[model samples]
Target chain A: MIEIILGKYNYWIYIALMMIGFYAMIAKENLVKKILGMNIFQTGVILLYVSISKVSGGTVPIIWDKGGPYDNPLPHVLMLTAIVVSVSTTAVALALIVRIYKSYGTIEDDQIVVINSHDGDKEIPSEKASTII
Target chain B: MIELLDILLLLFLVICAVAAISMRDLLSSTIVLGSYSLFMAVVWTRLNAVDVAFTEASVGAGITTMLMLAALSRTKRFEFLYRKKGQQEDPNKETNPLLKNWKRKRFSVTKVSGLIVVLLTGAILIYGTMDMPDFGDPNSPSYTHVATMYIERGQPEVNVPNLVTAVLASYRGYDTLGETIVIFTAGIGVILMLRKRKKT
Candidate 1:
């Protein structure tokens, strides 16, 4: 039983990470914190796909002087794309946060609402928002 | 056995998930979530998917946490929980920001809608999985028809061991090009979101 469990430890870890990321994203109140949670969540999915591709006793993809078959390389390339996408999402999220801060003078969702409700400013379009930025 | 260990690890994952969701402090939850991602990286390694494992370690554990922290920095740390006794003292105090419409608050249509969405997604996923081959079965149709060629001829075509990459980037180069385009679009989105607009 122990041997069997050991064999699949990686999958367990993947599932655990996914749950934690999901929980954080759902539970967090802070916008920044939520973004952090989202990051974890996305990463969890990436890890899951990578783990699923691994094979035992596999060698690196590089063909060495020994001339032997090695592990697959497909996951690596796909992951590269995923990393880039995650970074882009992060950049956009941070920018949104900055804009929110500038307009409301606070980052809290509740506070922003209170401020906006009090202020006479209507829903500013993206065009107007960027102009102020 | 490996199976037992897998079960235990799965259990640990479940516990961490529960803690992450139930925890009161959102910041701590986010950090815990990061830990979860790191552990997942280890899982990927054990599965023998080295490439996937590496990406997970870097992107999942590294990039995601960074983004969450960035977003969190700009928002409130806590949800204001309402106290029953305090509300009686000041009727004007709107403790529940969501209490705008008594009817909506009494029966959260949004929550109901979210549940419906979750259920529909779950049903679709379950249905899709029914047609999928069992994990790691070499005899599956997926292996026999499409994957076999790549496994057999991949070395000569691309000089790469990882058939997955060969199929993704080289054979289906068009798809890869599309992915590049998608990334470019995402980058553009980030730029647009962050760009400073000129004053009138």
Candidate 2:
């Protein structure tokens, strides 16, 4: 039991980190908070991948005169790409959020739904509707 | 890995993650998120992934925070709680006395259900981790594959000391090109969504 705990503590912590992000994404109503949760979740995955590449006594994957085992470079290269992709996703998601705010005048998911449900009935007055859309 | 430093960093990360999500002010939450990304970069460095650390520092902490702040500037900063219809109409007026009492005690269905779902998923993920190889074990399946070949001959063939660069640019050049295209497409999409049209 001790060996298992010691060996896998990092995995457990990463999982916990991921769950925090997951909770935020699901429970938070604000669109920006959801986006922040998505960012945290992506970072958690990246942390897990990078953690997997560590060789116990290895140094960085740069060739030097000192002969020693080097950490796996594959995961590092992969995560580098993943990080860039995450940034790109954030940019696009934020743009969508901005547009949603412009159209709905609110970024809350529930409020947006309320606005949509009232769309067909034209129950909302013209003055408020003009500001909304 | 430096075990003590690793534990400290992970603890800090968890705190940052919780604080970032729980803060009512969006701007402050974004700043905390930036610090979380910075700490993440430090953790990556401790794990011997320098290239990834650099990318996280620049792209994660720098660019992502800037984008979020820009979005916040365009929108409201504070997250508002769901207001009752009666409350929205008049600040002091109560439509129904019983309804006001019921609203005060009402719980959010979304919050409760979301917590249940998140906990279930987390439990499953923790169960899956039992079969995973121990951290930093050189004999793990990941190192037994092409990683060995890449590390041994990568420097000699590509004449680059950094094996990450050699693999990313030479061994996987097409993959990098595809990623570049993805970023380009994202940039174009953002521009299209945000640009204002001239009045005709």
Candidate 3:
């Protein structure tokens, strides 16, 4: 049990981090909070990949005079691209959130749904419709 | 000693994650998320992933936070509990019992269901981790495959001191090109979504 805990605690902690993000993404009513959760979820996956690449007694994957042992470089390279993609995703999501706010006057997911449902029952006033257009 | 540092850093990460999600103010949550990224970068460095640490510090901690703050400037800062205009105007007005009950309680059915789903998925993922190799095991299968080839021949063939850069810029140049295109496409998408048309 001790050996398992020592060997796999990193993975367990990362899973906990991921679960927190997952809970926020699903349960949080605020749109921006959902986006924040998504960001945390992505970071957790990146952390898992980086953790997998570690080598005991290994230095960074930069070649020097003596270079027998080094951490895996592939995961690092992959995660570098993932980090950039994550930022790009965030930019797009924020843009959509801004547009959503412009139309609905609020960034809460439940409020947006309420507005949409209300739209079906009674036509939105002309001035509000103009802003949406 | 290093393992202890790793555990401490990860603990900090969990705290930051919880705080970021739980904060009522969106701006404060964004700032807390930035600190989370910063700690994540330090953890990456301790794990010998210097290149990834650099990217996480700049892109995750810096750019993402700035973008979130800019969005917050354009939107409301607080996650206000939204009530219908009718409810605000006349609290005594009769409404559907189900809707009224949901509005009164902080924890709705949606929240409880979401929590259940998240817990179920997390349990499955943790079960899957049982087969994974131990952390930092030098002879793990991940290090024995193409990773070994990349580390062995990367410096000699690519003539770059940093194996990560060598692989990213040369060995996996096509992949990097694809990623660059993804970023470019995302940029164009944001511009299209946000750009205002001239009055015609």
- lDDT accuracy of residue B184 in candidate 2: 100
* Cα RMSD (angstroms) for every candidate in the order listed: 6.6, 5.6, 5.4
Interface CA RMSD of each prediction in angstroms:
5.1, 3.0, 2.6
lDDT of 2 by residue, A1-133 (tens): 8788778777877888898998888888889999999999889889889988999999999999986999999999999889989999989999999999888777877766666766676554678778889
lDDT of 2 at A7: 89
**If ranked by TM-score, best first, what sequence of candidates would result?**
3, 2, 1
DockQ of 1: 0.26
- Which candidate, 1 or 2, would have the higher DockQ against the true structure? 2
Candidate 2: interface RMSD equals 3.0
User: Candidate 3, which CAPRI tier?
Assistant: medium
Alpha carbon lDDT at A47, candidate 2: 87
**Count of clashes, each model:** 35, 0, 0
Where does candidate 1 stray beyond 4 Å? A1-80, A105-133, B79-107, B162-169, B172-184, B195-200
> How far is A13's C-alpha from truth in model 1 (Å)?
10
TM-score of chain A, predicted model 2, versus the true chain A, to 2 decimals: 0.87
Compared with the true structure, model 2 gives a TM-score of 0.88
